[model samples]
Target: MPADKKPNSRTAMQPDDASRILVTAIEVGDIETIVALYEPDAILFSKSGRAMQGAEAIRQDNLGLIALKPTFTIDFITATVSADGQLATNRMKADLAWTDKEGKEKRGSVDTLEVLRRQADGSWRYVIDDPYGSMRANLERR
Candidate 1:
């Protein structure tokens, strides 16, 4: 069965719920949804090692990614919540597929790490999103 290309309507108010929302947002090519999942001062580390800080910068970066029309599936590997339950970390393996500029289908796998914080409204938002963390670690092993 093919995956749905729409963001889940359910609100991501919990840490465990954020990953699914992230994947769905990307799959649906919704840049606003992607930005809303992050903290206002969050930082995103791109695959090319570019650091995008704050929601505006992250939104701009996500706009470029949305232009690619990428579809994503994330498999949660592990999650650790802080004692206070205000901070959490989620590690996931992601499969991504997209059509290239030449209309050729491209696919790849990545391991992602997200640090999320509980907001005043009790919603979970990522403070740091590093989608290429595993790739960077692998390269460092060489």
Candidate 2:
């Protein structure tokens, strides 16, 4: 299924919930559910670190990942909400496994960063999602 161009009602009530829901959706390869986690004009970063804008673009990019049938185990590190409670950031560590084209299983871990906004309905949706944001986090750990 394609992205609906709008965040679905099945959204997060808290910042960490957004990350949890997204990882779960990806694990199950639920494209529709995954797209629903982002805002219509959200920015998503591809595995190659390319920036993709809008829902359709995000959906197309995610299709590539879904094809790999990846599994993720995420441990949320921190969730900080703005003083006004309208914006938040979620930081997490994700261990991922997927089958390569050669039918070999590959595994890796990365830190993920997501920025979410509180919708009019009080639900949280991602405005920016960057799986590769771990580069900076990884460097900091060094």
Candidate 3:
């Protein structure tokens, strides 16, 4: 995609469900809530550079996220849906902090791309999401 190409990819039914789930999944750190917005076999590509497949994978990550951070805020700069209304992607800048095993808290801002898949029920879920958008570059070889 060229800079002047103006990449606007979104569907008519993309915004409502995709925006809500994207915000809730990160803002509240609720995995189950996020999962409810997804298809049972959806795949997740996280910015942390991990590929979590299915509800079970999402559940495990969500549980750890809650326990580790408990609080995190996500801000969306822009988001768009696929033309078919089956996919939506968002650009989020996150502000978060977590306690390490050594009892120290680590915090920072990371650039990421969140990809959501709209289910058959008009709901949205993460199909291949990422916390750090650049992680995909690293995943290419794997």
Q: What is candidate 3's lDDT per residue for 5-108, written digit by digit as tens?
A: 21122222453445445444545555545566556776666554567788888777767665665334655456787897777787767667777889998786
| TM-scores of all predicted structures | 0.87, 0.85, 0.65
lDDT of 1 by residue, 27-76 (tens): 67767778889888999998876888999999888788778777776665
Off by over 4 Å in 1: 1-6, 140-142
Query: Model 2 segments beyond 4 Å from truth?
Result: 1-9, 136-142
| Residue clash pairs of candidate 2 | none
In the predicted model 3, the residue pairs found to clash are: 10-81, 11-81, 43-127, 45-129, 46-129, 46-130, 46-131, 47-130, 47-131, 47-132
TM-score of 3: 0.65
| lDDT, residue 31, candidate 3 | 53
| Model 3: CA > 4 A from native | 1-29, 46-48, 135-142
In angstroms, how far off is 138's CA in candidate 2?
6.5
**C-alpha displacement of 22 in model 2, angstroms?**
0.8
Question: Model-by-model lDDT, in order?
Answer: 0.80, 0.80, 0.59
Q: Point out the higher-scoring one by TM-score: 1 or 3.
A: 1
Record all residue pairs in model 1 with backbone atoms less than 3 Å apart, i.e. clashing.
none
Candidate 2: 10-residue stretch with minimal lDDT: 1-10
